[model samples]
Target chain A: MSKVKKNVWWLVFSLLFLLVLTVAISDQYYLLVSFLFLIGTMVPLYSRFEKKKIQSREIVFLAVLGAIAAASRVLFFAIPSVQPMTFVVIVSGMVLGSEGGFMIGATGALVSNMFLGQGPWTPWQMFSWSMIGLIAGLLKDSALLKNMRSRLLFGFVMGFLFGWVINLWSVIAYIHPLSWLAFIQAYIASFYFDLAHALSNVFFLWLFSSSWIKVMRRFQKKYGLLD
Target chain B: MHTVLNDVHPITSFCYYIGVMILSMMFLHPVFLIGELFLFILYNICQHNGAKMKQMFKGAWFFIGVIVIVNPLLNHQGTHHLFYIGRNPITLEAIIYGGLLALSFCCLMFIFLSYNLVITSHKFLYLFSRISPQLALLTMITMRFVPLFIRRLTTIKAIQKTRGIQMDSGNIKTRARNGMHLVQILLVCSLEEALQTADSMEARGYGVKKRSSYLRYHMEKRDIFSLILGAIILGICIYGKLKGFGDLQIYPSLGSFGLKGIEDVMLLILTLLFTGYPLILEGREWLWWRWQK
Candidate 1:
């Protein structure tokens, strides 16, 4: 409990610091600020995982979900920007809770990139997917994510959010002067890809997430995994 | 795969790629970037043949094109205006900035391509394992499960198709539904088995003590030598960066393209050598092989 409190305090402090940092920094430093932002946000989650005494069962369970998510990515490789990875991650989160969900999401990104080829985008991909899982798990019991329709809505939003986060790298790296016009233009250029991703997430969640969640929940209960 | 960096220690190569990546981002100068890009492209050509390089270009040209074309249109901050579509002036500085950034990104992409070829999955895992043993173990398990799940998915797809649950032969929504259903079945079946694998692992005493790696990587004499050279080169580059020697100032006004002093020339040469670290090793190996014969 104290550890959780400490983490929350750290989070609040970092959020405040980041807000100030972004407002204070110059435009040319956008790339450096964004990187620092990524590292700052990611460190806490990974450190929490490191501090815990993880079990073999939990490790294997997360690995299996990650592998399944990555396999779906590879299977749907022919389709551009359309995969059920987010759907799988959402279901994993809904079943396994936030920590498990974050691991699976991150692991899924890492493993999939192994088969697909790693690039500068790998870290961004990991960050986006992991956030999706973390948010889903956090909201699993909330009224916002209770029903299938609302869950689908969440997935849809997350899909675009994921694309936008990935687009941040390019915008930061390439956009000169870093004006709002340039930022908006970059986002606008990638609009179609984000739309496709969002629609696919909605489709997968609407048609299949409930069943995936049910199966996962059953496994969790039967094996007492992640308890 | 007898690639150039194939035998180099993962630590050495990883540091080299990371150093070059950081330096490329910092050195916005055209001379620095063009020389760096040229060396990496040459290294990439050495790593793969002409046909593969063409395929890489095909994959990368879209992003490069977008950056080159979009920057000048949106950014009107520079002094020298090239032209204007309407109200927005296409300044020479924005165009030059865009081109340099595109070149930098293209170089990084080629470097990553070489990274993919050389580091491979196991080496990456090995590097991570040193930092966090548990995370490394989890990644290894995840890596192991990927191919297994892929095979299982293929089998499940075959069985599902036999039962008329075809994923590829339907409309978009229907196909997507069928696909998720297949994955759901996979999840249900695999979860139980994965737990059993966990149980077997427990039986074999997995979490008892420190886990050992299956494949060992050594930091050999050459790797050490390379590390020493890398440290010196990158130290100089970083020092040069702090002194604002390699970077060009483009905003407000354009900076001159010529070297300011002897320090600038030396820094430029060091930056190129640092970026060409992989090629240096490859060339040495090529010469050694030929000379021995």
Candidate 2:
């Protein structure tokens, strides 16, 4: 009981820390604040996985699924910003729980950037993709995400959100004395790529998400994974 | 791998890269950032003999060009009006701000290129494994699987090409659908095999005790020295930035570009040391080799 209380306090503290970091992004220390925000949110999630008594099957499954997501990014490189990584992460969240979903999204970003190139954008990409998975998993049992229509809608909105959040690294760090005009201009500049990403996400989720979820659910049941 | 920077502990090198990256963002003046850009580019050349540097430039120039070209057009808040493209007034201060943005980004790009070269995957995983062994193990397995999955993807694509689903032979929509189909197949097959791999790991008693690293990197004397030097230089840089030395205020009005004080000169020297840390280390090694010859 005391341990549970301790864990609750930790959770509250981290959430408050994340809120503070998010507010602090508008301060002069843009890069540092965003980096702290990513670390603050990600470390708690990752540490929870560490503290748990996870099965080998769970770890291997998450790794293989994340690799699949990363490889598909490389495979679909011919298309510009039209990868199915978001679809895979969302589907994984629906099948597995939030923890499982967060692992896949985080590893997907880290590993794909391994093959692509690592830059200042890596942490932002990791944060954005992981949030997609976390939110999807959190809302998995909800009636809003119960049907196919809303799920695809979630994917579409997440696509734009991913682009917008990723663009923050540049807009926050590089844009001087940030104003709404410059901020809107940066978003406007990325509109074409973001639209393509959103459309591709919808397309993949609409056509293949059901089967993918079924396949993952079957594996989870067979292996008694992430239970 | 045997170079001076890579020879130091990964934590030292990691701290070095982080220091430079934060400095790049902090120093928002054109002259300071451009100096950083040149130092990092020279460091890249020293790191990889100009091959990776070329690739870095190829990938970076587009975004750099975009920002430099776009900032002036969008930001019309500055007072020194250069001219009017249509009714929009582009200012000299805005142009300088754009160039500063581009230079900082270019510095970041070069810094990352050197980072990847210096801190290889084994060291990266090792560093993180100390923090959280589970996440590090997961990352290792995922990194190992990426190349294997890419290879399996090729095989699956070839096999599927014998069937009706071919990415190249389709229209845009069809091609994307076919590509996703290929990925779905890869997913189903790999998820099954991954369970077997997991069983194999359990059979081998994977989590019976604390995880031990195969590639061990303990901090040595050189690492300590480098870390201390890095902290000192970083301290001076941040101290100087807090005093409003390295960064230029260019939003409401442009700050003077000339170094107007002794503290400014000191800050410039410290900034040089901060950016050129790795280059100096590697250059001294080269000179030592020549002296021995």
Best by DockQ: 1
- Please list the C-alpha lDDT of all candidates, in the order they appear: 0.84, 0.84
Candidate 1: stretches off by over 4 Å: A18-26
Q: After superposition, how far is residue B18 of candidate 2 from its true place, in Å?
A: 0.8
- Candidate 1 residue lDDT tens string, B1-293: 36768787889888988888888887878888889888877887787645766888898899899899988887788899888888888898888889989988988887787788888898898888877777878888888888888888889999999899978787877887787788888888898899998999999998898766576777799989989988998898888888878767788877787777888789889888888887888888889999999
User: Which residue pairs does candidate 2 place in steric collision?
Assistant: none
Which numbered prediction scores highest in lDDT against the true structure? 1
**DockQ list for all candidates:** 0.85, 0.71
Tens digits of per-residue lDDT for model 1 on A16-62?
78768777764457777778777787777887887789889988889
TM-score of 1: 0.96
TM-score per candidate for chain A alone: 0.94, 0.90
